[model samples]
Target: MKKQNIYILAIESSCDDTSAAVMCNDTTLSNVVATQKIHEEYGGVVPELASRAHQQNIVPVIHQALTKAKIDKNQLSAIAFTRGPGLMGSLLVGTSFAKSLALGLGIPLIEVNHMQAHILAHFIREEGFDRPDFPFLALTISGGHTQIVLVRNYFDMEILGETLDDAVGEAFDKTAKIIGLPYPGGPLVDKLALKGNPQAYPFPKPKVKGLNFSFSGLKTSILYFIQRETAANPNFIEQNREDICASIQYTIVEILMDKLKKAVKQTGIKRVAIGGGVSANSGIRIALKNTESQLGWTTYIPKFEYCTDNAAMIGIVGYLKFREGKFTDQSVTAKARYIIP
Candidate 1:
């Protein structure tokens, strides 16, 4: 008998981005993300505005996803949605929509953990890209999360360590803000760091034991360093923006690499994979590649599109759950603090 193909429509409104994706048997046909630009004025995401944007963008985004995939809603076998580890309001927009859509289409609903989706994103089938095998080490870094996970299997993951304070992305954004950069300035910092001296300004690294990380100290150091320098010379930041960015980026990368080295040594798992928004940083990418050559480790870095929050990652997890018949009932609601189990 020929195998039947499964279609899953996945929704991701975890934070500020409203995304929808269509997947057929593990292949993503289309992934549409409607990012909210309203928070630019505020310098950070406002929870209420993000949810409102998600409400407005969800329907159209989903429509575009299905249209792009050339797949009808009736053909969907299951609807998957990010169920937690996100802002409650944003998660609600996707959760309610997925539930209603699954009910309307008479299909099953699969609940996906946002963090797990980041890890499972590697499993999405794409040519010339190899997925990490089971029991690989996964580093998930983003604005809200910084975690080192021991992925034993698809649904079985152990978080060996995580951020005690600010995530690496948060550190970047906050540092950028300190130096008078615009909102969502993490990527901008990465761009400017390319032309500057990485060791120009030294920021202290946190001495956290084990694999856990603490960036609050680093952020404080940067903040104080800027304040002290600018007090003596008002144009200090203007005089050395690129070098500051490079130095900060360098410190953050070293902090991350130090922990990753410890994780590899302790676990004996040389297959290192990274996910989430911060994984897209050029410095971190280069650092990982260098480790691949120097440490004799196999590294997995997803494409930029997959590095950040996207529905494709959710869709990949959805497809995996569909295969396992892991359906959730309507009682499942949005969770703001869902832990990876």
Candidate 2:
């Protein structure tokens, strides 16, 4: 007779999204994501506000994940949660919930790296194609991180390069705000970039020494440029919103692609992938697709749903870790920073 399949329930509330999923090995039966609209009122994610929202939303979110997957709590082999590189309070809610859930179910607990989970998310939905092979280049871009990572194995990863200043998402959000978009405006910026000219305003890419990036300067530059342009011609942005979005998006994408191209060259890996929220951007998608022909590399971009923070990702990561017997003790705790001790 076949063995009883092991299941893992995963939760992610590292930031604004309260997500959960149930995965049996690599096959995700259900992936549930709950986004916080409360944050929309603020110009950005207010840390404390995010935590409260997570607390309110986590229980129902988790239950829905289990129900959607048709997997009962007792059937779960282990529980996983995003434990760090996120807001402390935000991480705490998920961590505490996971710990309590695991304790209640008498199952093992596995703590997942929020960033690493984002990278591992590729394995969740399987993307309906040949999955990315090992020793490939993965760019994890989002609100707090912009990194080029080398994934050699399930848990083996090295940071080839990362942002030195503001993250790509921050750049997008700030740029969007300057252009009169609402908070969390990255998506809006992408939407507006379509009708605009990519060559409208040429923003100079910062001369960062290596693969490390610097988008903070770019954000400030855009602000000043907008201010100056508005002073000279009040209708400059009003008449050319699309152009502004296009130009700004182009500059940011160029910075990211430049480092990615270098990583491909240095690592000598032809397979490249992009993950994280910004990976959902149409511009980034087109840019990465173009790299396939331009740089002679096989490219990967997980399906749009898998790109953002979600439980299926954590479950995928959990699937890998579970096989290795990588269980975290009851004493496991959430971290706010990168280093684990």
Candidate 3:
């Protein structure tokens, strides 16, 4: 049974985002996310630097979450943290902190999978939203991951398919760079693509043979095309900005939504949801809404708050685990490749 007044202090440092959240029962009391801006200079996240930033940001982030939630440290029933499927060093900081906090707070410690937490974000309460039932299908996309998942329960998760080469967010980032967008340019690409014609340049679609995906060809195609086009016109991208961005964004969105459609058909599952950072893309959301209507299925997308990395999602999953008497020991270790379906 679900517990009452079960306040949880959750920590998330899976990647470039350092976050903390407080959960009271099933509701998120407060969520604080600190994103690393240093990656902007390097054009992508650097593991070592990300870890360092986590070390610096975690303490303050947690303090802020608790402060905003109006919950005292002694009020927490348990401590929850993302334990795996992220950078090793970054995960370590959150793990070690959670372990220490649980020990100090004298409560149970619940370890969470970053990917699974993305799925469970649906459980975080919002006034007008409803939580998903069991056997739900999730399309989780991020800079590090692109996967279709099946959630049978709080603990039972399986991965249906994933990218064989690059993740969907990676494709977006790479494509954005090719188009001269700033670092973490995936969102920008989507925005610019809206102003441009989607058919300006046809990008190659990955014929990945199976449920697995490959975006290497698509990235290479863009790179080569850009190189050749710029060689002739130097200002080719500048001149046809909207078209290039639109075409690439269109192709990537199609690739993702197509695979998602197939996953639905093959599994005979009507309920569909999308999560992770890229789930915030306007293009993906619009496509999912349209597809859901055409396919006659219920579609779930977390509000932007839960879409990005946040400890509230972790805390929500931890709440479920806590109810099931799930707890982690001191020997619990961080895993860098946590997968779920």
Candidate 4:
């Protein structure tokens, strides 16, 4: 008997980006993303506009993914999509498309939790990179979420700690906005931080208990501090932009690291991994690496491409679930808030 090959088409439209990927078995053959620039002018995502953009981009993005992978729609064994913890409208676009496609092709449909996809991204096969072992700690930080999760196996996770209010990525963007920076200012702050003194301005760290984290107080402190400084000297921010950025980034990194340390101690798991958008920050990367040396710990960090929201991550999870025959029915709908069990 000849072995059957499995090809999966994955779609990710959780928030602003419309992405699609073609994965054969465990390898991702092609990944294409169409980022919504429409959100930039609005300082953040407007849910309605995001959905409209996804509707426009989804077709072409999937077409490109299939084309690049040299696979036809008929070859797909299943269709997988983010079911969410994201905007309702945006998620509906992808969910509807995936359901329609699966129905037309007479294939199975898989619903992937967005956050779980982020954690499993580390398992994508890559040369010279080993995936984290079972029972490791994962720090999942992004624009909307900040969490320390304990992973025991594929889809088996426990939330050791998470944000009490605003996420770390929000802390970064909000600080940037307060300093007169434009939308998507987190990366800009990171770039400027490289040239400034991280200790130039001291921000208060939240004294949250246990492995949980909080950035709401830090954001408030930054807002008030900036206001007070500008009142004293209107040019303070302009003249000290670099240092201020550096300080903010430094404080955020410290808070994240502090909680990660506690989680490690609590779990006795030295193998740590990080995912989500904020994991792309250079400072956080360096800090994690430092722990590998200083604390004799092992760390796993995804490539820049996989660090952000993309269908490839969803594809990886889909492939794993396909092996177990875990498929969803046509009735599965996009969820605005889905938690990992």
Candidate 5:
């Protein structure tokens, strides 16, 4: 007998991006993301604006996802959505929509943790991509979070270490802002860094004990350094844009790899996988690639589309949970600080 196909509709609105996706088991059929350009004017996300955008984008985004997937609502076995660890108002938009849709369709409702979805994104079946085996290390770096997770199973995960203050992506964007870059400057910084020297200017790394990380000190130092330089040379940023970006990227990547090396030594896990928006950085990608040859470790990097905030990652998690009969009731609500379980 042929196995039954499971179709899942997933939604993710943890922050500025409102996304929807359809998945058939572990394979993504269609992933649609509506990024809010309005936040670009503010140099950062405004919670009120983000939530309002989600409300406007949710219906159309879901419609497009289903249309692209060529599947009707009746064909969906379940609806999955991000439940938390993001802006409260943003989470509510996705949560309420998923709940109402599931009830209307008389299907199961599954809630996915945003961070876990980032890690599990590696498992999404793709033509050229390979999934990591059980018992591996996952470095999750995004605008709102930075965590070193120990993944022993699909749902079994433990955060070995995380940011004490600012996340790595926040550090990147904040640094970019200081240099007069536009909002959503993280990618711009990465693009410019490629043409510059990584050691052009050295920045201090935080001395956080154990596997935990800190970036507030580094961000402050960058601020002061830029302020001091531009005071003498008003055109300092313009004259040394690439070099400055390269140095910043180098320092941040070092901090992440140092802790990751420590985590590897402590746990004796040689396989490393990375996820989240900041994982899309060229510097971080290069650093992880070097470890494969120099340190004799295996590294897994997801496709670029899965790197940033998208519903495809959420759909993959939903598919996994659906397989395990991990459905939630209508009583489920959005959580702003949900941890990996």
Candidate 6:
């Protein structure tokens, strides 16, 4: 018998970006993301504003995705959405829409964990991207999370270590703000760091024990350092913007690599993969690449589009769950703090 094609519509509104994607099995046919520029002025995402924007963008975004995929809603086999580990209001928006859409289309509803979607994003079919085998280590670094996860199967994952306070992406943004960068400054820091010297300003790494991570202290130290320097020369940030960004990126990348090395040593796993927004950082990418040559570790990094919050990641997870007949009923609701089970 010939295999049947599965079409999945995925929704993601865990934060400021509202996105939708249409996936044919593991391959993404269309992925549409609507980023909220409103949060740029606030120097961070505002929950209320984010949720409201989702309400406005969800329908149009989903429509665009289906249109781009050249598929009709009636062809969808399941509706998948981010269920939690994010802003409650944002989660609710995606959850309610997904439920209603699934009901209307008489299709199954699949709930995807936002963080897990980041990891499973590696599974999304694409040219020039190789999927990691089971029993590999996954480093998930995003604005809201920093975790080292052990992946044994599609649904089987264990978090080996995580952040105690601020996530690594948060650390990057906080440091950028200390130096008078704009909101959503993480990418800007990465951009500027590329042109600067990583060793120009040595920042202290946090002294966290075990495989866990901490960035709160590092962010505070950066703030104080900038303050002291600016007190003497008000143009310090302007004069040393590139160098400061490079140093900060270097320190953050070092922290992540240190824990990843420890995880590799403890678990004896050499296949490493990275996901989430911070994984897009060039410094971290370079460090991971260096490991492939220096440490004999094979690293997996997703495309840039898959790095940030996107529904294509959710769609890939939905496709996986659909294959196993794992579906949720109408009683399912959004969870703000849903963890991997």
Candidate 5 clash total?
A: 0
Candidate 1 backbone collisions, by pair: none
TM-score, every prediction:
0.99, 0.97, 0.97, 0.99, 0.99, 0.99
Over all chains combined, what TM-score does candidate 3 have? Answer: 0.97
- lDDT-better candidate, 2 vs 6: 6
Model 1: CA > 4 A from native:
none
**Candidate 2 has what TM-score?**
0.97
Q: Model 2: which ten-residue window has the lowest total lDDT?
A: 121-130
Q: What tens digits encode model 5's per-residue C-alpha lDDT throughout 178-197? A: 99999899999999999999
Model 3 global lDDT (CA atoms, 0 to 1): 0.90
Q: Write the per-residue lDDT of candidate 4 for residues 108-187, one digit (tens) a residue.
A: 99999999999999998877778998999999999999999999999789998999999988999999999999989899
Off by over 4 Å in 3: 1-3
| Candidate 6 lDDT by residue in tens digits, 1-341 | 99999999999999999999999999999999999999989999999999999999999999999999999999999999999989999999999999999999899999999999999999999999999999999999999999999999999999999999999989999889888899889999999999999999898998999999999999989899999999999999999999999999999999999999999999999999999999989899999999899999999999999999999999999999999998999999889988987
**lDDT score, candidate 4, position 59:** 96
RMSD each, Å: 0.6, 1.3, 1.6, 0.9, 0.7, 0.8
lDDT of each: 0.95, 0.88, 0.90, 0.94, 0.97, 0.95
Instruction: Indicate which candidate wins on lDDT.
Output: 5
> Candidate 3 — which pairs collide?
149-341, 150-341, 158-341, 159-341
lDDT of 4 at 252: 98
Better of 2 and 5 by lDDT: 5
- Give the poorly placed runs of model 5, Cα more than 4 Å off: none
Q: Would you give me the overall lDDT of model 6? A: 0.95
Full-model lDDT, candidate 1:
0.95
